[model samples]
Target: MNRGKLNGVAGTTGALCAVVLLGNVMAPDAHAQNSVTLYGVVDAGVTYTSNAGGSNQYALTSGNMGANRWGLRGSEDLGGGLSTIFTLESGFTIANGKFGQNGTFFGRQAFVGLSGSWGAVTLGRQYASSSQFVGPLASGSSWAAPGMGYGTHPADLDNLNSTNRINNSIKFASANYNGLTFGGLYSLGGVAGDFSRNQIYSLAIGYTQGPVKLALGYLNVRNPNYSFWGNKANDSTTASNITSPVIAGYASANTQQVIAAGTSYAIGSATLGAVYSNVRFSGLGATPVAGLSSTAAAYRGSATFNNGELNAKYQVSPALLVGAAFDYMKGNGAGQGGVIYRQFNLGADYFLSKATDFYAVAVFQNASGVDSRGVRAVAAITGATPSTSSSQTVVTAGIRHLF
Candidate 1:
């Protein structure tokens, strides 16, 4: 009887093993279907400024060509042309190993969403629709290396270079339809008592066919001081993070609006592009907050800025490119008088490989008339300190690597 029992046990064990092996053979390999990627860019350079705070200066700069960043992107197939996707991107200063974007980790972007043939929907901190659709056509955000701001409008008031990001936002991007695409974004104010306070919304449409591309975008912000300029947690009604003399005095404006359009055409080895934008700060000095500074309170009524830009680039070879751009900005408002800015940019880039490049860029800006602060306008490069004089120049040489 003991011998019979032993044989029976052995047979049962063999059956179980065979079942396990069969299950393993029949099951799908989930790991093979899912994928994750790591990516990053590093940029460093030496810069010379003709004037900064009344003096010429030389320094080492980080992110001259492109911001330093690292990120993880992943996707998992859920079948039926649907996939779950996520991204976490962080920006840092290569010069000192410090976090960028107000010390927020994953500050540049952090989002998760679903995508398929229709398009994608994501939620998190995100760029405005203008940055997505119109920015690419602008040389400042495109081929102008060593400094994305080199060719942008003064202070990037139109956000065509994506100087600001929206927090607590939801975005939708449509799939390409015969080279046409569109998208929108809305940000929640998260204010307990006011639904519109600190709120922002934007929309954009783009078309690309053959060698021609065009895009248009619109952005509206309620309480731009708190919504667009300040951090997400910032709640001060009387204070702001805006330091640019270009628009600092308009920080208390009740609403900010931007409309922009851009187009580009490629001909042989040469490309030409043009952009126009209008920015408005309405209801300035409408609400007088307690402890408001005299500088901010002196403003009244509305402020408007109209900007125009033209750029050209040529591909000298497979690995070398040269570019030039010109920009003009005009500002007007009650009590603030008239302001005008003219800027010029030139750049050259040489690619050592697919993932590495060396670049040199130069920018010059001149300002005139009265500024938002009711004082003489001074040259203010978007990424550099405001000049004490009406004219300023910046030159940079940099190296950038991508992985």
Candidate 2:
């Protein structure tokens, strides 16, 4: 009962400790095995357009197939079905090694949240609920449209690609329940004494069952211009402004509201998608144009735009895909009426591997009728040159690698 007994007891305790430690490591749901992963995409491309600032042009570009950027994502299990998660994603231009999203390092996404069986709640910069739910239904946001911003819903006015990630946002995303999900987002305006000024919020719902998917969403922004581009202290305009000739004139509206719905169906190796969006810019404010007469109401009153899109994609094989989309838009408001736009997008991709692919895309757009300022609308793709006339065309070929 002396030395031998004590040594035996100690050995037993040491063995038990080792077993418990090993169990923690090999346990199916062990939290201590959490990890942080690093990932990124690098894309580059050559592009040419039938018109750019009134002339044909060619150039090198980045983020054509997908954005070029790096990110860190992590998840830490906390027992049960709960976990703590975080993401920091950055967008960059590989061509010149410049940060995208207006030079912010983590422009694409930066959020921390908790997850459980029910869903997740995230804080910080994030995509609004509308974009999160309905955007995927569009070909531009999906596979049919690639090469930077080529395939978005026109100038992406509906925020389908979420070019404008909500700042200081609180977002709630539901877990998939029988293939259905919903979410909401609210962005704090940070303006003292004015709860609504510069505020942004949205709600969205989506359903996915086998071969079909559908989504619907609504978004509202107060002091639209100020909310998106205004500097924090003075609400002064930022350097970057909306450049699309489609609705650029009306960018100063006090309020912007959007309702969007989309649906898609998969048949064999082909997928077809449709999207509709209604956008209204009310409480309109006059915009100061560079060359407009001081007395002219460049952008004033209220305006509305209706956009529709049809898109299809076919997987030719395991490594190849081809797709096309047609888009139409009509606008009225702020004294401008009957403005219309038509666009066509086509693209193809060949996968070299799971992490790399080559892609080609072309887009053409035509503008008709009056613009927000009662002038002929000009054709403008999101990242392309505004056509001197009513029509513009662009084509791009690129390669993207993911890690």
Candidate 3:
């Protein structure tokens, strides 16, 4: 249950329409030795933003807590203690037709893999470790959508610019060993003379036993230039990191990295979870402006952030579920410094069948950053950012189906 999802109007929308009608492989028609499945979420909602820059903006949005998308997945057994598995997932928007991430075909996921008791090794595009640990443990990821402040510190920061999925990468995930499982992923740069640039690596560990669940992860990305997605600077009350500025631009401290930890507990029909994250940004490769000393450049820039969250959910009934979440984040030194954001999210869903469901939700934010005017988030897919005001809100409703 990660915060960010892979289905949106990012370009694959055309394909999504065609695939939806095909229906996940025709339901294994008579005399067929092969089978495949199609699935998707059709979530559309009317949103109302309170105090949206002095005007209440009301509009329809998609992919709030979860993205609106359709996909195809299938597998065939080789009959030799092995199987061939593959998934081709695409993302689109019901509200509008726009390709996610600049028109990618399979922005959600496109991969094939071999699986067995020795764990699983997969290839192609897939989810990142950040989403595996930090995301589900936080409130914004589970509850905060478009209506709240951007999100927790790092606000899916580990998602790598909302790119929870990696391309041209090889991944390995081991089966649970007593209560621990590990995963690692690497992406080959595929470019000449830039072995380090554009390469990504992630390490993650997960544990589950009885009523306790826990996760820890680390991610590092080498960006040749500055990108808010990878090279974010985190600061504290007393000092600033020279590499990351609140505003966007290219900087020399091009390397980005993060460390995170999270935990959860389940008791009967209810469960509780919490997470803490420390994010840092550094300009190890930066060259200050001419005549500007490193010490001077350090003052105007730098970022250190602390993010914390608490979450809980109740089964309530066999066909219904309800949940609530709260999150907080603060930045120091940069434009976001003294930036404090508090978020609240509440929602419920009811299932009509095993494969169909409907849901409704609301998100609110109160903050002291960005001049106390507060910013409103109407869509979850735009990703999280600092708030512009001290208060904001968003409301949503939609439907989903699976096959």
TM-score of each: 0.89, 0.87, 0.75
**Per-candidate local distance difference test:** 0.84, 0.79, 0.58
| Candidate 3 structure quality by residue, lDDT tens digits, 106-201 | 777888898777777789877776566556666555544422223433244445224446667788888779998888888775668878765778
Cα error, candidate 2, residue 27 (Å): 26
- Per-residue lDDT of 1-29 in model 2, one digit per residue for the tens? 01122112443456445744774678656
Stretches off by above 4 angstroms in model 3 are 1-35, 143-155, 160-163, 224-253, 284-302, 333-336, 369-388
**Which candidate number would show the highest lDDT if scored against the true structure?**
1
lDDT of 1 by residue, 1-403 (tens): 0112211344445744574366358845534437656577889999898988989989899988888887667777999999988778888999999988778788888898999999999999899987889999888897665244766788888988887888899999999999999999999989999898889999999999999999999999988877788763334556666778888778878889999999999999999999999999998876445554686687777999999999999999999999999999999985466899999989999999888999999999999999888889999987888899999998989899887
Candidate 1 deviation (Cα RMSD): 11.2
Q: Residue 120 in candidate 3 has what lDDT? A: 74
* TM-score ranking from best candidate downward: 1, 2, 3
Model 1: lDDT of residue 53:
90
Error of 2 at 37 (Å): 0.9
Better of 1 and 2 by lDDT: 1
